[model samples]
Target chain A: DAGITQSPRHKVTETGTPVTLRCHQTENHRYMYWYRQDPGHGLRLIHYSYGVKDTDKGEVSDGYSVSRSKTEDFLLTLESATSSQTSVYFCAISRSGTTNNEQFFGPGTRLTVL
Target chain B: DQQVKQNSPSLSVQEGRISILNCDYTNSMFDYFLWYKKYPAEGPTFLISISSIKDKNEDGRFTVFLNKSAKHLSLHIVPSQPGDSAVYFCAALRAQPSRTGANNLFFGTGTRLTVIP
Candidate 1:
């Protein structure tokens, strides 16, 4: 389980509204990531954080932003929701700093933008 | 372009049989590979992984075979059970100069495996 939890396991919102999904971890892992899983795309990284206040963009980072102000928490925000943005979002953590390091995933949050 | 690809979208197998899921990648820089299994409405869980240095890695009834020369990899599940009927994803990792040791992964589209009871 990786001591991970995601808020609003399911959500529905209209386009143009801002939404934030929170990922919390009980373990103090140094690396945290946010990814969106879609049918054809599989899982694409949206953003990741290496340490508190340090974050970077991922492959499909458009329209999304992330913040990790604390070690155990990483938040993913959609600046303006779009129907295309509707997908299951996943949060993962790794102890190491590398991108290919073994990762543990949270349950996931399904967001629907109408 | 998709760096990692799972050509098969779905595969069916009978209980107690063997199931093979194939994955291919285009990036020769990728040295580490991983497999993850996901049930509907849940997050993917790490299954097994193989480094480019080895051709095979085994844990219990699951094994991953890597063919670096062909830029291919396969996950084999022996004695497939109905419980093993889930989506399997193949991922590859290469360190980018931008992020020293950070291991961001490139994932395949995934294959849905169904083990008929």
Candidate 2:
């Protein structure tokens, strides 16, 4: 297992509230990713960071944003939570300079919007 | 459009039997493929992978077969155990140097494998 941890293993919030999920890695990997897992949809990438202050949108980046100001932390925020945003969010990290390298994952954060 | 797809939503196999999970992709630019297994309430873990230049790669009980011409890949687990029950995802990436920061993976919908003992 990689030294990756995601805060707030589970959360419940109102539809219009703001929600922030944090991912921290001790390995100091250069690549980090955020994904949401839903039934029938499997896992969809929301955003990813290649380095500090360098991030890009993924297939399902709409309504979600990410920030990586330091090497060890990656944060995913929902500006205004929505019911459709309720899902299992996962954080993954992979070392730089390797395309086939494996990604280590955090336990995951399950969010529910009411 | 879904570039990577796992058509089977779920699969069942008996203990000690062979469990075969299938995946397909429509993009020809994808040159590297990987399989990940996920247990409920936990994150997905890397299982196996195959490069486009290779047809098959194996590790322990897991084996991944890639058919570039057909744009398909399959994961095989022999002597499947109850612990093997989980949702498996297939992912693909376009070949690019890591320094370029262009490595983004497209994932499949996943197939839930249930091994009945």
Scored by lDDT, the top model is: 1
For model 2, residues B1-117, the per-residue Cα lDDT tens digits are: 889999999999999999999999998888889999898889999888899999999999999999889999999999899999999999988787444474677889999999999
Taking chain A of candidate 1, what TM-score results?
0.96
Candidate 1 has a TM-score of: 0.97
TM-scores (chain A) of the candidates: 0.96, 0.97
True contacts kept of each: 0.67, 0.54
Give one digit per residue, the lDDT tens place, for model 1 in B8-29. 9999999999999999999999
Interface RMSD of 2: 1.7
Q: What is the Å distance of residue B68 in model 2 from its true position?
A: 0.9
lDDT value, candidate 2, whole model: 0.91
Worst 10 residues of 1 chain A by lDDT: A94-103
Q: State residue A64's C-alpha deviation in candidate 2, in Å.
A: 1.2
Residue B48, candidate 2: C-alpha displacement in angstroms: 0.6
Model 1 Cα lDDT, one tens digit per residue, A1-114 = 689999989999999999999999998998888999999999999998888998989899999998888998999999999999999999998888654578889999999999
